[model samples]
Target chain A: MITRLSWVSLLVIMASFRFTVDPSFYPSARSATQAPKEGLAYVAGLYVGTGVNKPDFIATVDVDPGSPTYSKIISRLELPNTGDELHHFGWNACSSVLCPNGKPSLERRYLIVPGLRSSRIYVVDTKPDPRRPTLAKTIEADRVVGRAGYTRLHTVYCGPDAIYVSALGDAKGEGPGGIVVLDHYSLDVLGRWEVDRGDQYFAYDFWWNLPNEVMVTSEWGVPNTIEGGLKPEHLRDGYGNKLHFWDMRRRKHLSCITLGDDYRMALELRPFHDPTKLMGYANMVVSIRDLSSSIWLWFQEDGKWAAEKVLEIPAQPLESGLPEILKPFKAVPPLVTDIDLSLDDRFLYVSLWGIGEVRQYDVSDPFRPRLTGKVELGGIYHRMRHPSGAELTGGPQMLEVSRDGGRLYVTNSLYSSWDNQFYPEGIRGWMVKLDVGSGGGLSVDERFLVDFEDARAHQVRLQGGDASSDSYCFP
Target chain B: MIYEALSALIGVFAGVDPSRGWLYAAYYRTFRGDKWFSASLVVVVLSTTTTTLLTVAPALIALRTHFYTGFLLLAYGVNTLIHGALKAAYPRAHYSGPLKPKLTHLAIWSTINSTLSGYGLPLGALTLIQAGSQPYFYLAYVPVVTALATASLFRGVAHARSLTLNYDLILSALYVAVGAYSILYSLSTILR
Candidate 1:
């Protein structure tokens, strides 16, 4: 029989072993100083200003390795309003000819940024000077609500005929939110695109496999209900349960199926680039009630859409077991918040917010996803160590893939209020770059990290983008 | 009318969320409140019970001396003991027909019939207190209680006839359902 002293000795030896182990292994790759295929990537940076709803502005970060001030902020475009939460934005025109409804010009001329809370959309002219982007026009919230009867503008995407904007609530902020349509070139309010307002209320994200004539997933619940802090009751009551399907050309509702009673709050619908492959992936953000955060694969069979949970991102247990200080909040997984597909439709990248890690998966076979690589960063439980010897606070939340599928940039902030609840250490404003190998392996780029220690930065967009805007209708 | 009023009163006291209330209402409208479905379901249950007894009785008698038979009986005894313990821990308010005193005492003791009736009686009581007598509550409770009472009576008759087949089958089915219900109930409570 082992005594207490023997157990203590065993514990001590294990702890020492863990401390001495090398955290990450570096594989052979090209030099970090090699030039990217897209030339100089002028990244459109959306950051929260100095104070509460005060300093929210869009800046440009020169991400090109060959540039003199590479990985440094080049220009700042300040917004007039303080409270406009500048979140997700998309380009007006893409360089690909396969882009839906085909624009007259393929220049990445305009960048459409949506104010998540304020309901305003800013149209920025990036063509004037890609580095120094200037705000051309602002689509006021009141004007959109007046015409379209929807509020809380969430995601902006360039569809075939017009730009589609997913909003969270109605004019009075009550949900069953719908999508709003706008003229691609003129920025004209074309009105709401909801078919019949059957059950879909909370709209978060939507993507289409244009050739398959289908759009797979859409989010549920309102911003106010979901963003009002992380309460267990609020999570169960406020999150959504259904994944809707729509006809691509007709812009009409076809079918929808509930994912699961427990798997709620479906976000980030990442559809594969191969239009013939009628399959896409979505991740669900659940609270402690369901700590096993999962990624679901939705596919079409004989023309109807159905989804099944493919993989669960497991929560990492505390090394020394649960400490006295963390006993109250209960154990939770690294919330899988965002998902992005590579341009070539080979690799899938997922962001874990609660635990700081970006997981990469090879999803060539949509049903069976094989884990390729994972890079741990700052999170609620584990604070990531920066190269400068500083411990970053929050984990990765939003992910953006490079056009060539060689690089990935991630920022760590979900929402203003929810960010504070999870990462109580306060938002450490920073974004990191990961080098993606051709075989779906990942390595953190030691030389290319954008540090914004003062203000909270989020959602990175490339100068002449590739993936988000382009849609291949014919494989 | 009085029972309906009392059920409504208990539901109000239970204070379930509005979402659950909607679920309860929908379940009531579809299953319990629909006379044709309820009647058909009762017939199906009775026919299935008769078919199971006729088929399984002779086989059990033939295998009476088998080693598997002794193992099954041992497993059943352990299941009964655990079920009794659960019933004792979570005591419920039981009804003894109409115009009878409500039994508030926890079931610390166990009988062969009570154990064979499965853990459904105690589980139903707990669900009644937590979700009240809402149709959603009855959706699981009514069928379970009915199955238990019918199975217990049939088990007794089967034992008297010296053919333990029906008794064995009913007890096994009860064991599976009870185990599943216990796990799901615990999960729901903890998660909530």
Candidate 2:
């Protein structure tokens, strides 16, 4: 008879199918259906709890493809900052890539997350080991006028040849904002560039495609004068919400393509279900500057910008008719923070912070995102947390699905102190591990707890309290 | 070092992390050998009781503008004394971590993180809550909140075991100075 130890070794060797990692917005496909296991759900996430006493930023990587393990953390790293968790891992490789020359490749090799106020970048150099990373550099924020006041660090992209960082303008930069180009290898400051006269340049949300062009979604920071974060009733609050293409080689702003009509919250320059081709998606594209609604900013290249309004993230479908329950969140936009396409591009994965759910759609054809499978991951959003404190609730922020299109990972509780001031203290912030396979369509295999009891994870908008908690209700 | 830090951070979040939930729970069973959740309950009860009591206490209600103003000044003076000591000791001492910071290594993780990150709304809420409370409550909330934040801020340092006596010694000196400033401030605002 075969021994039990032999069985374990064989089991470990046969890892299950997996999902994408490193990046939050873009879910890339892996070469294998599973990581060699039957229960492997390759998706995972890290949640940092700076607000709580036991504020341990956790790392939960789901290896089981069948019954996904939730609340999984390989370590207990105390992440800095009491507000806002880091977003989007910086890399191209799934497990730190080693170049053919035996050198380290940044793709999945490591991750770069900005310490917003530090005016510095916190890079976890995972090239040393796939599971554990080393700090590569602590690059300083750009110094303007000898004082780097609010040069908040947003997004970091390490391209095949160069690395680019976008900086939000001083609370009062006339145009959109600015972009800082750096040498990918040396991390040297290449040059500082700004947006066009009428463009509203926002930071953090931008996409860099192959060969030449880089697209940045306009938050319309300037022109619209969006210095403070997004607020309702701001008629002129639409800048960088549009897609601004910059020619990296030439180092100048090329053209600005409006996103049909939606406030550009974030943008991803990832493949459209295929490794070879890359497409752009801009979500939180709302007209009233609300969080709901989005216009997919698709581009494989050519000349014209192929934009489509895939979904109308209704305000609050269930309570649309009930005013008392839906008053505060009324004008509040439906929060469709991040979206992804399956490896075949036949399915779409969208994470809704306000609703706190990750949805799967059949996108076999371009321009249309047909709803398919769905799983509500007790989100990290306080605004949407079942007021009665029910178990089946959530505040899902960013999300990604596995390669074979099985597992999913979603984070809730974005924003920090600023959010506390704005949002109600209802949500228990944390990461929700979703196991997505079909037993019964899109399912919820588990709900891992990421929040500390005292410092619960709630949406920043809920910091203000009850009145502002439930206004979102739309069709 | 970065990945190590990240992995460590993730480690803390994983389970063995002492700062948050595991330690107290562990101390209850493994170390203190108390009942499950008992150790945590004690702290929770005490803190909650203290916070609730301070909410309506008379000592804090009166401190609003004048008393807090004095305390801020006193705290500033205490800060100067400690700043002078730090300058004398290291002169140019700067740190990131290691020799394995244990848990507390996070104390000086960064100046940017310490002074700013996520301090806004909570601080504002504290301010507003202090305003709503009676005079005695003011005394309780102010120092209590500061002490709690301080304890939370410094919790990792003591347990890390990697920190030197010098770190503790410096912390002691600063604690005393801040204590004097805080006590004076809290006591001054007391109604009777």
Candidate 2 per-residue lDDT, tens place, B1-192, comes to 322332222222222211122223322332233443344433432433333333323223334444344444334334433442442343222221121122222323322221211112122223332444433433243335433543453345323212111221222233233333333443355422
Candidate 1 colliding pairs = A49-A55, A53-A82, A100-A160, A101-A160, A176-A201, A177-A201, A202-A221
Candidate 2 docking category? incorrect
Q: Report the CA-based lDDT of candidate 2 relative to the real structure.
A: 0.40
Model 1 stretches astray by more than 4 angstroms? A1-36, A39-53, A95-101, A318-329, B1-192
Please give each candidate's TM-score.
0.63, 0.52
Q: Candidate 1 at A73: error in angstroms? A: 0.8
DockQ, 0 to 1 scale, candidate 1: 0.00
Docking quality level of the chain pair in candidate 1: incorrect
lDDT accuracy of residue B70 in candidate 1: 28
Residues forming the 10-long window of minimal summed lDDT in candidate 1 chain A: A20-29
